[model samples]
Target: MNSEGGKVVCVTGASGYVASWIVKLLLLRGYTVRATVRNPSDTAKTEHLLALEGAKERLKVFKADLLEEFSFEQAIQGCDAVFHTASPVKFTVMDPQTELIDPAVKGTIDVLDTCRKISSVKRVILTSSMAAVLIRQPPLEPNDVVDETFFSDPSVCIESKLWYQLSKTLAENVAWQFAKDNGMDMVVINPGYIIGPLLLPTLNLSVEIIVDMVKGKNPLNCRYYRFVDVRDVALAHVKALESPSANGRYIISGQSVTINHIKETMRELFPDLCIDDMNGEGLMDGINCTMCVDKVKNLGVEFTPLKSSLRDTIISLKEKCLL
Candidate 1:
């Protein structure tokens, strides 16, 4: 786990919004990286990774699937650590279990199982979300200070049909139990709504929300939203892997603001664009909660400002002609 030398590591879902950033940072840090993607031959999905600074000599892309048993064996075979960042993030699906829940929960198990069999693998950093820690049966009190100690209630999530939250909650829970039973060294990062520059031409859910708003569409149903920079989240994963003192889950969030606050900022930054006003009551209209990041800060993580993050997002969108 030392920060020195060119240690070999594997990153799952390497072409994703956040995972791509993780891969870039890892390569810059001089680590020999084995990146796994569903289809390595797809240039559109992998060109960004293949063009990184040290990619030609230090990066290798492997083909893997979440549901297929032992599919990650080749990618994780000789790595010193694994970063499991692959998961289904759809909001609407005909079959929640088959589309969202099964892939997330089963995907996590398959990655960990591969790591367990690899004698050279020493640690794992799993990417979870605040959705797993924020949702509850009875909504949190207005004064509640949420942290890693809080967990989303499965019964409540299922009753409300919050399949995305339920999937994250279940997947993270399963990972902890598996790690404990098998005596594995593991760390989990629960990040908020991630936003920043895009590495790929395609849009992700978070960035797509911003694009929708810029085009005069109101996509969010919640009154309060949390934000974090994708770079900060990626740095936290590397820090967690290198620091031996790190343990348990860390909540990585930069800020929590009202929907109106975000809209105002967007308006100021992009005066030329026509941004729509959100109408009707929101899902979190009156619920007030705070996410504490003291744990992540302890690992030497400094978050990017909200305004700066949003400004960079718009610029990246424009560069890709998405705005």
Candidate 2:
């Protein structure tokens, strides 16, 4: 194990699919990690985290709720760095404001506020989604190449009822403002659709899409699909924290392909699995945009190939009996 010189860090939403990987990587890199989950008593949510290598000696699980103010204080205190990955991710909800926006915006502010109070905390790495970069007003052109400069338009999100996208955009916006106002060192990682092996027994929304597709269910409605491995996303967070020069927002994406391309690749890899195509019914049939990963690559992240990611995802699902 490469010693981090007794560096201690805090990761909020530690039980989550992406955050779980982050905790595992941090622990493996010899960093003492304080992982905060909603319920430490819930074995289902925390067992995987506890089971990771080096977890017993270097990992501590704390209970934290996003909506509860000052709940993250104890978990973040005395930490050298903080990774704020806790956010509400509901694509469709009856009350978008209460179910999505409130938790996302309030939870970010609460975490940052706690970090600001702690003098030991030097840097913060926030996990924002591609949703904040993809959806925009007037819509992106087919030839548009999206980079860190692009941001999802709030007006378009509100008018189109893109609640999840709006929540991430608003939360990230608030985080930047709060950090600048308080002179905090903050780096944001905007990852594409996160897919790969599951550390938790449960399935996240991104992995669930692949599982649904394998079961002959068509869950994809977008013409363009962008994906990155969960492990890569986790590594990006660590890299952002370790690299002193890492600043601003970095877009971490692996592959950009079409729905048909995904279907073909799956069929080629797992011919036995019953995978169905969308039959050219995608919402944005002809519209396509590229996600620029040049910024993240500069962080020394060699992205895991999408084919390998898809294969491992299927293998993991089969092992978990979710396929």
What TM-score, computed on C-alpha atoms, does each candidate reach?
0.96, 0.96
TM-score of 2: 0.96
lDDT of 2 by residue, 180-224 (tens): 999999999999888999999987898998887676555766666
Clash pairs for candidate 2: none
CA RMSD, predictions in order: 1.4, 1.7
lDDT score for residue 257 of model 1: 80
Each model's C-alpha lDDT?
Answer: 0.90, 0.88
